[model samples]
Target: MVIRDTHSLQLVWSSRISEDSTFGLRWTHSIHRSLVEEKYRIHDGQIILTEMSFHDYGIGMENELAPGEKLDIQDGQFHIRNMNRHFPALHLFIGQVRAGHTLLFSGTEIPLGSLHAPGAAITIQVEKRSILNEIGGY
Candidate 1:
């Protein structure tokens, strides 16, 4: 997987992700001041949004459920499950330090703010590379 700044078209971060690789993006909701997390997995060479958990609903929050989607409440947190939304590329707005935008992958916490300035547009997507290119470190 790779993350790039959309405006400048500069590579911000890149990592080798295999099939079934899962990651979560977490940030503080600007209005609610609560932590919100969205989990995704790489399946069939695509990015699928698996789950979303948040403390409270605020602006831009999805209230109505779609087909095959389920909502669960536990410990005062709302979890939306079975989304399985496919995206060619995930775009995110890197919020300020107060938002605490972070990426959780492979047991590592990477702060997106450290990679680019606040309010930067970031695009994350999976890229296919041949075995030869991988071996050559391209």
Candidate 2:
């Protein structure tokens, strides 16, 4: 299948890193994202990538851990080291590796409900929004 007019949207993940353990340690949640470049396709399978910028943001907090200080994250928690097993890996469209054929964005999986079509072309428009405009600044 030939892809036309492909435009890449750079995504920055604001994922939460959690620590869980059988011990009595309180659960802590911190935000961090892998410095990765995310390119989205309009028709990646059953899901269509719309210009839905509102649905594109992940809300989380900033990380405040001292360097070399390890967090006590037990098994089955949302840590950066264990995130790969819990979420889908980043998608690529080159070489032996190809973009995932599922509805996923920024390591999160989206559900596909009866929108699977074959041989369809989809278009997505990206709107530019400055930080000033987002914060009600003129």
Candidate 3:
């Protein structure tokens, strides 16, 4: 997986992800001031959104569950599961430092704020490259 600056097309971060590799993006809701998280997995070279959880249901939250989707509330948080949504790429706006935009992968936390300035647009996608090509930085 790779993350790039949308406007400049400059690579910000890159990592090798295999099939079934899971990761998550988390940030604070602007209006509700609560935590929101989206979990994803790599499948057949595609990004699949597997689950989403949020602390509040106010503006910007999904109002209703879609077919084959399940909604669960636990510990005061709403979790939507079985989404299985596919995306070629993910575009995100880097929120303010307080929003705490972060990437969770491989049991490590990578704050998006450390990679780009606040309000920057970034694109995350899966890219295929040969081992030699990757090592050569081609």
lDDT of 1 by residue, 91-125 (tens): 98999657889999899999999888888999999
In order of appearance, the predictions have TM-scores of 0.90, 0.18, 0.93
The C-alpha stretches of model 2 lying farther than 4 A from their native spots are: 1-100, 111-116, 127-138
lDDT values of the candidates?
Answer: 0.89, 0.25, 0.90
Question: Whose lDDT is greatest here?
Answer: 3
lDDT of 2 by residue, 1-138 (tens): 111222333222122222220101111122222121222332212222111111112454214333432333333222222111111122222211122123343354532111222222322232334556445575
Candidate 2 Cα lDDT to native: 0.25
Q: Which segments of model 1 are wrong by more than 4 Å? A: 130-138
Query: lDDT tens string, model 3, 1-138?
Result: 999999998888888888899999999888899999999999887899999999989799988877899999999899999998899999998987568899998999999989888889999999886787567655
Quote the positional error of residue 15 for candidate 3 in Å: 0.7
Give residue 55's lDDT in candidate 1 (0 to 100).
95
Report the poorest 10 consecutive residues by lDDT, candidate 3.
Answer: 129-138
Higher TM-score: candidate 1 or 3? 3
Ranking by TM-score: 3, 1, 2
